[model samples]
Target chain A: MSTDHLDGNAAAGALREIFTTDLTAATGTCASCGNVATVAQAVLYTNAPGLVGRCPGCEAVLFRLVRGPGRAWLDLRGVTCLEFALPDPS
Target chain B: MATVSRGFFGRRRSGDPDLPPGQYLVTDFPVLSAGPTPRLRTEDWEFTITTETGEKHAWDWAALMALPAQTPTVDLHCVTKWSKLGTSWRGVSLDTLFEDVESAAEYALVHSYGGYTTNLPLQDLLDGQAWIAYEFEGEPLEPEHGGPARLLVPHLYLWKSAKWVRGIQLLHDDEPGFWETAGYHNYGDPWREQRYWGD
Candidate 1:
């Protein structure tokens, strides 16, 4: 019963490296508990070895990102599908 | 015609020979966290050590406070590349806690109240290397800074000094905890600048 998790905004800086657009608004379904939420709404953990994004609905990890040394590794095994809210390019 | 791109130099590295590589000095302790800090009450809090053979050694808050306390001033280095030097803290040393517990395990995973965990060699936590710190700068630890009690393994990255610490689980084999399984280096040595998985 760890009383820890972080706000979604914490992932913004690290995620910006991999995505052209803000992915925080992107919604995704959780593979474990079938929860749906935006990246920002997930229970995030930043003070670890990497950034962990977990589902707010069931606490399942939605995505994991590790960034350093000019490289980044992202694992989406906890996610089922993602629907992005990209802005219209005129 | 050619296109130009941003030539990134790298993460900010300092030339300070004393501090760890790639770290900048921070006067304030940053509130880097997993989520919101778990509210841990000392009255209800207890520290436990689970040995590999199911032997459990535990101490309630009062019992823990009964032990001798040490005042240590040490530097802290975070994996995020921030170094806080000569931080003053008062707490019970892990050596005092492990005085009676007998274990043959080689590795240990430290667990905190809010479900956060990190692993290191059992030796890292003993021999005057670590503590269950409860006070900082002559003040009770605030929740944000892992108050109630937090592991203080200053030699390693600050993450190893888990916030709101509750117990230690000794294991026969290495079991990677939160960050170790995720992307942080298994053996996070600040001197080597082992921040990420590979380096």
Candidate 2:
């Protein structure tokens, strides 16, 4: 199948269900490719069992999500680590 | 069979027996895809079904159009919790395609033009349960919605109804598809709430 994919921002809404901050702006490294980039740069594929985010460098899956009536599942096996920012103290 | 939509303005009436568990009603058909949509021209498109022994049954646009088509009205339950009921579709039945095909295979791996694959029990595709739908609600299906033709198997979760369908490879053993391998339920049955690996 010749497929197209959107960037991680396309999945920000669905991800908001779990994250308190902008996970899209957080830097993450792909477990397979070691490419470190903000989640927004990740290629996202919507329209399946859930939203999938892949690495731009290797096309390896970085995250997977599946939602139900009252529950949601997010898999980040392809992501090695994620770095999020905290608000500055006054 | 009354129409129900939980729109931005109103709430849905709980306990609607028609919908499977964990599903909500949607008046609008939501577009979801694992990748970008494939634009397939009918003239260049062909469908194939390969038996376990490598016997190929192929049909091009013209050959497919010549077959007797059926209109099916069915409900669609998505793993994302959206369910659309009483949708109409026009296409050739899988029964006609598999009528004379010889295969002892119990499973089928459906391939799509976009490199997407979804597998299911072969029996789920026959006996009027499936179709290669070319039209939806009296209109030619558009590319994003799996135009040209898409597998229409309303009995299972919509994911099993592969979009941008290309062919089927009959297999003796069960095969996990794109989503299935990506932590999705191997056999996605919406009614059973099988949305993930264990559920």
The candidate that achieves the highest lDDT relative to the unseen native structure: 2
Model 1 misplacement above 4 A: A1-27, A31-34, A45-49, A58-60, A77-90, B1-17
State the iRMSD of every prediction, in order shown: 9.3, 6.3
Chain A TM-score values for every predicted structure, listed in order: 0.73, 0.75
Report the CA-based lDDT of candidate 1 relative to the real structure.
0.84
Sort candidate 2 into its docking category. Answer: incorrect
Segments of candidate 2 deviating more than 4 angstroms: A1-40, A54-90, B1-15
Model 1: fraction of native contacts: 0.38
Model 1 chain B: ten consecutive residues of lowest lDDT: B1-10
Best by DockQ: 2
Model 2 C-alpha lDDT per residue in residues B51-100, reported as the tens digit of each score: 99999999999999999999999999887678888999999999999988
Collision count of model 1: 7
